[model samples]
Target: FMMKGVTPGPLLFQEQMPLIWILFGTFLIANVLLLPTVGLLTARIAGTALRLPFNLLLPIIAAACVTGAYAINNNPLDVGIMVLMGVVALMLRRGGFPLAQVVLGMVLGPILEQHFMVSAIKSNWDPLSFFERPIALILMGACVATVILGIIAHKRRLTGGDESS
Candidate 1:
């Protein structure tokens, strides 16, 4: 994305708002289209997936991961940290804890905290001022919708996996 001049951050959200909307729109469209694609290809995908030798696949995946991590800024230390984090993640999984929420918190928590601090400073610490703008309502709607969809998807995955409604 940086090669395409599309770096992601709060600044990206502010400066590239239209791109964000476009991404959200495309993702919604893709989700709609994916259902039919999955329905048609599930059997073939399942057969292929079941035939995959996970024991051999693990080392290949690790190599690909290390290569990919190293490709980012060509940093060996970053690659090592990624491997360490992968080991930690594996341990967490073995402990029967859900990784998704943890991963989301790790990624989003700081950003959300930054936003909150900025918002408070800008509003003179006035919470109600956040909703004064017309755009705020739209943003709130989008956020609520996203949370609702995430919760629904999480529940469905937890309960039913691939055969979910």
Candidate 2:
């Protein structure tokens, strides 16, 4: 309907909005089907305390990783890069750097830089103008407040139980 530019009539009420509802229904159905199976498997694993020998597990994991790398393009070189990236992530973590953040930054950095450049050009390089928009300012403020609150909550959790006196 959106693509065709056809608006739903008043009688239909939410025909235009049903796509979102359908997506949510599908998500709920997937979660409902998977969650119980996952929980049962987790319980069974816990009870069995089943452990694969490192020798067996390592090859299985490596095979699966290589398969995934190959699946992307059928290129052995990609597997080499994937292994190198995994090793780099491990080394970075060992060095006290946040590996997840590094990966996220790397993944998003190009897209972010592109958008930043486009927005700056569109706004005539007035960076402050980006925050002048009401929605942008509100979103920025919300993000900052959330980070601050998270920090305070985390610090409190780290400090342990307070005196009840």
Best by lDDT: 1
Q: Pull out the clashing pairs in model 1.
A: none
Of candidate 1, the 10-residue stretch with the lowest lDDT total is 156-165
List residue ranges in candidate 1 displaced over 4 A. Answer: 1-50, 126-165
lDDT of 1 at 96: 98
Put down candidate 2 lDDT per residue, 76-140, tens digits, no spaces: 89999998999998899899998779989999999999999999999999979889889999999
Please give the distance, in angstroms, between residue 121's alpha carbon in candidate 1 and its true position after superposition: 1.5
- Per-residue lDDT tens digits of candidate 1, residues 124-155? 99989999999998999999999999998898
The per-model lDDT (C-alpha) reads: 0.89, 0.84
Once superposed on the true structure, which residue ranges of model 2 sit more than 4 Å away at CA? Answer: 1-13, 16-50, 134-165
Q: Backbone clashes in each candidate structure, one number apiece?
A: 0, 0
Question: What's the distance in Å from true for residue 15, model 1?
Answer: 23
- Indicate the TM-score of model 2: 0.55
- Report the number of the highest-TM-score candidate: 2
Instruction: Give candidate 2's root-mean-square deviation (CA, Å).
Output: 7.6
